[model samples]
Target: MEVDYSDIRVIGFDADDTLWVNETYFREAEEKFAELLEGYETKNKIDQELFKMEIKNLALYGYGIKGFMLSMIESALELSNNEVSQATLSEILNLGKEMISHPVELLDGVEVVLKQLKGKYRLIVLTKGDLLDQERKLERSGLSAYFHHVEVLSDKKEKNYQDLLSHLNIDVKEFLMIGNSLRSDVLPLVNIGARAVHVPFHTTWQHEEIEEPKQKTGYITTNSLANILEYL
Candidate 1:
């Protein structure tokens, strides 16, 4: 498929999972928490419980370390019959904070692609996570210079994309979204009459994968970030 990015004045990209590694760290911590809760509940049972708690907490608390820590504490306490120690709760919260403060490592070829597109395109980083966490990562990665703007959203919905475009004074037809997920990234952009390109990540986060593609839209799929240069 040929993509005429020459008319695209602004190019927005997703941060976590799209530009850098995010879900892997979360999955690691969850596995450790599961081991800690082994005597209280089976792995499958714990995961199912945690999934429900995650959605609930996401609605109530939004995203980031606070929401994740709260969800973990709730899951642990419920599975342990409300007998979880204050010390364990403290430990879990500290771990979540640690994950945010951790190093920023870009995915393979992300830097290369960013370098290639920087001067030619109006690059913006549109990510959804805790504000501080996103800021810390951007500061550490030193890739912040490449972007014209950085937006940390509460969620990736059609409204978020629409609002962003309105704020920037750009029409949806003149913008392109590049990201790793079809669910949060591509589908929402397609909904707003914008173009999107999906660069599939190797490890899929449960919340990030889209089983069905949004139809009759300018959505392109690729296996790597470097491959996008051909279409552009």
Candidate 2:
């Protein structure tokens, strides 16, 4: 189905994987975390338990590298029956710090696309994660000037997007969201009667994975950020 973007007056961009490299760091951190806990359990089991810990603690810690670090620590303790060494815990903390301090690497055509769309429509960042961390990334990304607003949502449910649209004083049909995750960035906006475009990242978190079914028509999927320029 051909979706229309002629009415899109406000375009919301997902910051992390959409504009810059993010999930890749998380994947690397997870591998190191699994290695650290290998003595307590198999890497596979450690990975599974870490994921469970993260999901279990989502409400308490929300999303970000800090929460992920906490989950890693908790998973280590649980898997090791509290016998995991203090040295290993320190290493885990270091891993989190490394991720937090890592420089932001913008994806190809991110600047060009933002430049093309900046004056054409209201451009804002709609993403979820640690607010400070996200802000730091934005600062490092040098893309902050392109956005009119920046929102760090605790979660990306349909209601969250609805509230965002309401807060921004944007009509549902006039909003367009572009991002990497179909589950978080695309489906919720489409469900809320807004347009969305999916730009798949090379690596995505397992939590954000969704099975694509035929016949869904409210959004468009582009292979790169540059492709979004065609619609907007």
**Which is the leading candidate under lDDT?**
2
Candidate 1: stretches off by over 4 Å: 1-3, 214-216
The digit string of per-residue lDDT tens for model 1 on 1-232 reads 4556667878898998888888888888788778778888999898888878988888888877668878999999999999878887777887788887789888888899999998888899999888988998889988989999999999999998899899998889989999988888898998888888888877876766668643546788888888888866
Predicted candidate 2 versus true structure: per-residue lDDT over 82-173, tens digit per residue: 99999999999999999999999999999999889988899999999999999999999999999999999999999999997898899999
In angstroms, the error of model 1 at 55 is 0.2
lDDT of each: 0.85, 0.93
lDDT of 1: 0.85
* Model 2 weakest lDDT span, ten residues long: 212-221
In candidate 2, list every pair of residues with a backbone clash. none
Q: Evaluate candidate 1 by giving its C-alpha RMSD to the native, one decimal.
A: 1.5
- Each prediction's total of clashing residue pairs, residues at least 3 apart in sequence or on different chains, is 0, 0
